[model samples]
Target: MDLTYVVAMGSERSLVVRPPKLNSLVELLTSHGYSVVGPILRDGVVVLDFIEKFDEALIGVESAPRPGEYRLEEHKGAVFGGPVGPMSMKRWINPPNRIAWSARPEGDQVHVDTPKPRGPRAYLGIRPCDVAARTIFGEVWPGHPDDLVIVAECTSVGETCFCSSMGTGPAAGEGADIVLTEFGEGSVLVRSRSDRGAVLLARMNGAAATEDEIESARSRVAAAAESMVRSIDSEAAREALASMPDSAVWDSVAQRCLACANCTMVCPTCFCTSINDTADLDGVVQRTIRWDSCFTPGFSEIHGGVHRDSVAARYRHWASHKLSTWWDQFGTAGCVGCGRCITWCPVGIDITEEANRIIKEVAHA
Candidate 1:
């Protein structure tokens, strides 16, 4: 082991040694009764949702370039676990378009369609940035606008992320219980920093590590942080571009934009949504929610009007919010820089590339 992978009960409660291999490591947790959830290739993308078992899942999985191109193929044996896929924290925590409480007609009135209760969940494979996103999400979802709704406790699993740039990634998980890392084939490194996390790891088995193993895990985390290729000085860039909302940047992107909502949909933090209703055969109604994008023609439609009648206005709002207003509203930038937005933008609108161009143009002039 190159780093301290496992920390046992007793002494200082710090990192111990030699990360366990994937399966052996997982066996430790599962045997101890903690359910493990992480990434799986689904619908052609490596998404962060739930998985029943590791049997056929997490195998032959791969993720390609970002800013949002996710072309995953099956690659065998101790995969790098790749970057945070196009999936975001929303899938696991928010339960997309949750009924927000549904409704059904009572004999003479309407009754609320209370959602099924779900409880403590342990998820694996979330990148550091998503963890930060989960924290950011908490502020918006549960505190002010809505009531306290604690979705789950992510007490176990691997941490492969580079949210450092956004001050959210690179594995600073005050929000996570157990952060998992793959040390070698079939082996994993579980480090529990919190009480809940420690309890979960206590159930898993692996001989306590010698000094050698602990160091091994540390090295791997350092490597993971440095290995990140997708990052932006989100704070700096956002500040620089803040006053340029009416600049030529939006128009440039609009020229190449397809009005496709792909970027917003795949983004982990883009939370805009559209709601619609369906009537049953009996003329009853039900509501459904699907992802929404500013690029869409109707997104900004106003009374007999669209507030953003021009493609420029619509696109400008998105970039500005991601780079600007998001901070005002949530005290954080809306973008996590997962790169999914770039890879899947259909016409391939590279936001970083666009930002650079705009900055350069401004500086030159």
Candidate 2:
């Protein structure tokens, strides 16, 4: 590697190294027995999936996201220009559909076996808010500690991004094994936060980064932070929602909501699921679990009928659970402020705007 790519290394963790040689990193991680998963453009939208090479990744593509509208735009050399897409990291870790267990009937006895996970997976280009969301998910679906988290500092913020108010960031703050900051033109600032990360950087043989190079990277992050346009006071929203369960905001939000469940599927931390079994000719059955959304009427179904009969009731349950009761269940709010729910919602409902309105109403009350 060139001397310009080199930077300082420290036992205390932060080190600067090569800029955006993402393909090489993919190769290295794959060789080290990790299933390399990263961002890629498919059908004019970015989705997180298993990527074999860096070229397959969305290196120069950007996304224009507004409430209920998303368009893919090409940016020739601007990697990391698009903030996030509809698919969150949840798709890979806690898949939408997976066989929970299988059972076969032989005479009067049944044989059953639960599916096991494959090798460790490495996630590239993850943002800080997504990292926080994953931490919230870990409380439910625990993964290995050694699973590498390669976080990228945002070079540009999305219009719907509210990570700033969530304190999760345009810049990744902890929970990452390795962090990357893009300084444009294929130059990136790399930092190894863990011993495993340090070992990986040492193998690259990149030169030390100078003081000026580090400062330049910081400036880029600051600019991205200032560019954020959406924000929500999560704490105040939680309090308001908790205090006003019978608030009229539900009817208002429901009028705009389609009960499509797109928001829950796109949310990185939403983890509701349902289980069912299927049988074939030989009396073989496979029980599977599929992702379930609260917006669906059957999700709250009981013996007589669905508990949440109206769309307004279902919407209320979803939002109230997300901001209010989620704290009592998960010890933290279930939202990471990725804003996927806003951009992908067919009706252009903005969660942050709704949250602020709820807070306003509660204050007036």
Candidate 3:
């Protein structure tokens, strides 16, 4: 995998690779000591998992995602079919549960041991919305420079997708090293966004994309954006949520919300974590970090009592933080509009609908 040819080539131009040739790219990554992870069909749905070959990827299968439901169907139209699945890049970058460190008492001296570092990871077939979510995750939990981001720009739109409204997708945005847009049949347009990506592209055997092919790819992405029916005005939603703390919509949503934290669990940008400490009888102590959700009553526990004791308050906090105060804190909205929260929730709580309701209420008042 000599990448010096990239420097020799000088120009980083888009190329069109046949679908079957993607395995060569995977092999190249593996040769460079990268553990390639891509979308694969599991339990009747597409999920991100480790892959050694491109055929293992969940290609030619489109996902139909709606509120409270998800279904997969065969579609020979594109290579990578779905927008996204329940899992995001967060699961690999920041795990659900991780042992931060462990300590042992050794002859009146305390010894601390941290977990070993993982090898470089290559995220393949990642959607643009999840790419944006990964950017947000980098802001809070920064440190995965070795990770390679290979984005699969959305050519097909899902029922619940709203990434266009969030200004995050349909086309791949920042944080991606390489971008791939699969056109009908076997052709895929690949572009390099970073030097490392250029190196990979240089090694790949492919023809330079024609001007017509590029324009066609762009048109497909634009069509996907236009097809999105669900949306939220980020600025308006932020203002609405900030102004209405006592809005009855909270109570209404709370009535429907099960407070099961399924939304938070599936959300790509929800990085709340809880720390747990345990000691063994042998005097070894371990500290672990696990994913936590604001929907949980214990999440807001205090000396007096739980701050957000009511389900309504909890719902309000989660929604407001996602669309409102998160701007003040992170300079960006926490929600990337992937619609996983909506699709995976048992009762189908739509964030865009709630945000719009809040905005409408504020306007009327």
Candidate 4:
């Protein structure tokens, strides 16, 4: 299959390819020692998992996700219908239980060892919202491979989605090797952003997309963004949180919150972590770093006692950090607006609503 490669200004190329050729793209990445990880419907939930084949990739399966309610609905013959789910790229690459290093103490000298770095991993069907989260997380943790981002633009919005408000997507931004836009009809508009992506395109042998096809892709992405029913006033939200640290709204929100930490766990940008030392029966001690949530009691532990003892205090800290202080640290807000925190919360605690509520109350006060 010989195909023409249309060179753009710098290093960008666009190709229109048929659906089955997606498998060829996967094969190419695997041949280069990349484990292809993408969306799969497992146990009635769309999650990021290993992709052995594109047919079972769960691409067109749409998730009817609301605050505290979620179910999968089949969108037959359509690919890439589902938006962001409870899982994100963070689960596959960064991981929750990543071990930084292991040390064993023998007499006066201690032996230290770190886990060997694994091969490159390719994340297929990743949304633009989560891509934004990954970009933010990469600034802090810094050592993952660079060749593995394959973004998929959303064709439809989820019930709780608000990525459009965050300006992160419905369409992917930069930092992707390959970006796929599935516009139904068993066709996909493929854009290559790097040299590796160009190689994969050459293998698939796709032709340069027609101008009409590119226009159709743009229209699809725009429609997806407009279809989103939820949005937040992020600028107002920042001002509200910073001004009202002792806002009475925190007490109301806390009463409904279970403090189960489900929101933080599902949040793609949340990077709070904790470390602990464990000893085995074989007289070997190992230290491990694991995901931690600010909602927990021990999260703010000190010599005397826990700092944020009340649920209200913990909730305040969580919201404030995500909307306010995170900007001070990263020059941008921590949330990517995927709304997984809203959908997965047992009580349907919508962060966007809470942020708006805070702004509303503070303005009146």
The sequence of per-residue lDDT tens digits that candidate 2 reaches over residues 309-338 is: 888888778887877889989778888788
| lDDT against true structure, model 1 | 0.58
- TM-score of candidate 1 against the unseen true structure: 0.79
Q: What lDDT would each prediction earn against the true structure?
A: 0.58, 0.79, 0.85, 0.79
Q: What is the lDDT of residue 336 in candidate 3?
A: 92
Model 3 lDDT per residue over 14-70, tens place: 444444466777888998889998888888888888999874345567888999999
TM-scores for the candidates: 0.79, 0.92, 0.94, 0.92
Error of 3 at 341 (Å): 0.8
How does candidate 2 score on lDDT?
A: 0.79
Task: Mark the regions of model 3 whose C-alpha exceeds 4 Å error after superposition.
Answer: 1-14, 55-57
Candidate 1, residue 201: CA error in Å? 1.5
**Candidate 4: where is the Cα deviation over 4 Å?**
1-14, 18-21, 55-59, 104-111
Per-residue lDDT of 1-365 in model 1, one digit per residue for the tens?
A: 22223554434554444433345444544555545556666776666554455434554455655443456655443343456566765765555665645566879898767657554455666666666666666664431221111111111122222255566545445666656554443344556656766665565545665555556655665675666554556765666567676778778787888777777777777767788777676546667776677878888887888778777777778877876788888877887655667777777777666666656655676
Candidate number with greatest lDDT: 3
lDDT score, residue 200, model 4?
Answer: 70
Candidate achieving the largest TM-score = 3
Candidate 4 steric clashes: 1
